[model samples]
Target chain A: MSILSLTAVELGRKIKAKEVSVSEAVEAVLAQIETYDKEYNCYISVDREGARTRARKVQKLIDSGELTGQLAGVPMAVKDNICTKGLLTTCGSKILESFVPTYSAQAVLNLENAGAVIIGKTNMDEFAMGSTTETSAFGVTKNPWNTQHVPGGSSGGSCAAVAADECFFALGSDTGGSIRQPASFCGVTGLKPTYGTVSRYGLVAYASSLDQIGPVAKDVTDCAAVLEAIASYDPKDSTSIKRDDYDFALALTEDVKGLRIGIPKDYFTDGLDQNVRAAVQSAARLLEENGAFVEEFDLSLVQYAIPAYYVIASAEAGSNLARFDGVKYAYRSKDSKGLHEMYKKTRSEGFGEEVRRRIMLGSFVLSSGYYDAYYLKALRTRKLIKNEFDKAFEKYDVILAPAAPTTAPRLGESLIDPVKMYLSDIYTVAVNLAGLPAMSVPCGVDLKGLPIGVQLIADCFKEKNIIRAGYSIEQAVSREKCEAARAAESKATEARN
Target chain B: MADIITDEMIDYVSILAKLELTPAEKEQAKNDMAKMLDYVDMLNELDTSGTEPMYHVFPVSNVFREDVVVNGDDSEGMLKNAPERKDNFYKVPRTVD
Candidate 1:
């Protein structure tokens, strides 16, 4: 098998054992990207030279008997929103198209310190404002499973890259289901670490409270490994939680015995496709059969999740994005009459339609007369959602839900109606609102052969619980596939006999 | 739901957001914002009288740090990305009349 197709864990082990060289693995990934990325549109920038230099340095370290870090020699991709020193970190917007940060984000530094070579920066929705990557100024990323469908957004490129084996794993920032939705659509394992558990020092803020940088990879194990590398506290991000180092990789035991998995009834309600609902329900059953207790529960506050998320996210986005106004380090309008005109023209020209729409809504909601009516009310509703999750966690260790309402939609199907696109994130946004860790793992495929993902959510700092539960679900799914293959093999033998 | 967003409201919001919208774009924004507001009006159905607002997920307040310089001054590196720069300062249009 090609080295590019191996999981991050397997590749790391092989590279360390000298059975595979880091250069060869990097070359394989580069070759794959060269051949496939043009069609997939998964990457915005590929740092081929930088990756080669890092891989060669890692090989030298391995030969000299001084190799260290869990992910040594593993090639990875980062979402374009995360700042990389001297690399083009355009958050998939024309405003910052030429903007390159002199300093790297904390997560990037952490990944590099762990010896993971970042091969490229992936495309994303403009400032992470949309559900489908169609809003990206660069271009929409296609699902690797089928070229006609979209890899869900705003971290669509990260998920697509991992799904296409352009890289072993990729880093994606989650604000209102950006990471998990795409992972679900692309048939990969994506984890959104509990808010504040991962540092957001250089992650361009979409919504400060909801934004988190997490991992997308081939499976739950690789997701856990990448999460371990990037999860840390940095003083630069004031919201970053100061905690002892966690070994997420050590928590990936396929033992869900006695674990309580709560299936929220609202998630299975109308608007969810039958295929997606069936796949998630089967995931719950798999966990139950593995000795875990599965029960239906009521999270009554779910209906308000979408409204509150949009209100708060747009408001925060307006305030955070107010920094770009033809000044400092972004695009500027050459035909400006004056200072005010320049600011208006620069932003109007630089931002995409969805981005401008969100900014307008944000500004409107935060305006003097509307603050109490919209923004404040949304915050209060956010508290109610958190209270509901807190109540649910008392009886359940983790909640099971469909990651998205359906499998990957056709490329332009969701973009026509904005509200319809917002509804796509119904099941996953509540976890971010509650500041909990959640993951999307591939469980089954739809009738169209597109992958379906099931979400597992845990209370704050309880990522280990979900990881353990997710590991069990992944094993059971694979076991079912194996059993089907065996049955087919025996049937064929009998037919021949 | 009331028609909370009008053309005037869109223009006012555009100015506040520092965005220059064309006449057609203004109409589109008005309609889009109206639909979004209609959707968010779902919050009006909830009774949150006693619930406190949660601006942040974490219950963190007043996170202070030592008043020491961690990153040394790198004016050259910071200015490298400036669209227009002059001697470590960003160049912009004159503000005073």
Candidate 2:
């Protein structure tokens, strides 16, 4: 098999066995990027020289038995929002287009310490404010499954890179479905660990409370392995959880027997495409056939999730984004007359339309007369949404839902109506609000040949449940496909006879 | 929801956000914000009587630690990306005469 086709763990094993050198692996992915990236725009930057230099050093460490992790010497991409020292870490916005951090994010540091080679930064939504990567200042990342369709955002580039084999796996931040939706669109596996499971030290603050960095990979096993490499406790981020166990790979059992999976009835209502519904239902049935007790349950407050998420996320974004001015390490306006003018002109010139809209919304919600009516009410609504999820978890070990209402939309369709783009996040946003662990695993392809993802959600810090269930779902889905393909072949032979 | 988002409101909020919008941009912002506000107003449908606002998803607060500095002053490294810099400082527009 081509070295480019190997999963990260497979490549790592080959590198360890000396069958595949780290340099060869890095070279293979870089060559793939050179071939495919122009068409897909999967990456904002590709670090060819740096990755080659790191591969040489990492190969030596592997040879000396100093680095022995499963991800060691594996080439991986990082979402642009995550800081990587000296590598241009634009958060898919002109504001920080030239900005490179002096230090790496805690997640990046953890991955590097595990011996993963940095491929480069992937594209994302500007300040991670939009649902489609079309908002990127660099360029939109197209779905590898179908170029006309969008790879969902703001981790669109990360998911697209994995789907196109531009990298073995990638790290993506999830704030209101940024990672999961894109993963679903691009037909990849993405995990949003329980809030605080992964430290967000250097992840550019979109909505600090909702953001968690996780993995986008080719399969559940790679996602688990990547998550294991990055999930950690850090003193730098106060929200970082000190977990008792970080061994996510141990949860990769293809057994869902007796696992209680809830199908939120509210999620299956109107606006869901029929193909997506059928595919997701098939996933549920597959899990059920594996001895999982799947049942429809009322996950109330579904409609409130979008509104509450926007209000709270935008409020936090407004505050978090206030740091960008003319003086610091971001783009500054040259036409400003004075200090106030500079700040105003710089932000107006630097930010995109969607980002500017969110900041304004945030400021309006937090304004004095409206704070109690809007901001406070939204927070209270958030508590109610979290309460509903908490109540659901009391019965179900894992909740099953469609990762998105439909398959990837054609480019420029969702962006024209911002609210429509926001509504596409209905199924995934509540998980972020409740700080639960969720994943999007590609279950089946749609009529248009776009992939449909089934989201598996577990209670906070119960990543093992989702991981275990996700693995079983992957196994069952793939087995069903094989059986169907064989049946088709036999039928064709019989017809000829 | 009432149509409360006006041109004046957009201008005021943009100023608060430290953004200067063009006339066309302001009109677009006004329209977009009005739509978003109308949609988010659906939250008022749920009666959240006496429910405390969930500021943090996890119950973490006041995460105090040792006062010792972990990262020493790397002024040169920090200043490396500054848009305009003077000797050992990030230079900005003059605020005072």
Go through the candidates in order and give each one's DockQ: 0.84, 0.88
User: Which residue pairs in candidate 2 collide?
Assistant: none
Q: What is the interface RMSD of each candidate, in Å?
A: 0.9, 0.8
User: Which parts of model 1 have CA positions greater than 4 angstroms off?
Assistant: none
Candidate 2 local lDDT, A1-497, one digit each (tens): 89988888898899889999999999899989989999999899988999999999999999999999999999999999999989999999999989989999999999999999999999999988887799999999999989999999889999999999999999999999999999999999999999998999999999998999999999999999999888988888999999999888898998889899999999999889999999999999988988999999999889999999999999999999999986887699996778999999889889998998899999999998899999999999999999998899999999999999989999999888999899999999999999999999999998889999999999998999999999998998888889999999999999999
Q: TM-score of the candidate numbered 1?
A: 0.98
The Cα RMSD in angstroms, rounded to one decimal, for candidate 1 relative to the true structure is 1.1
Residue A56's lDDT in candidate 1: 96
lDDT of 1 by residue, B1-97 (tens): 5386877788789988999999899988988998999999989999999999998888888889889888877688778777788997988876667
- Overall local distance difference test of candidate 1: 0.92
DockQ of structure 1: 0.84
**Judged by DockQ cut-offs, is candidate 1 incorrect, acceptable, medium or high?**
high
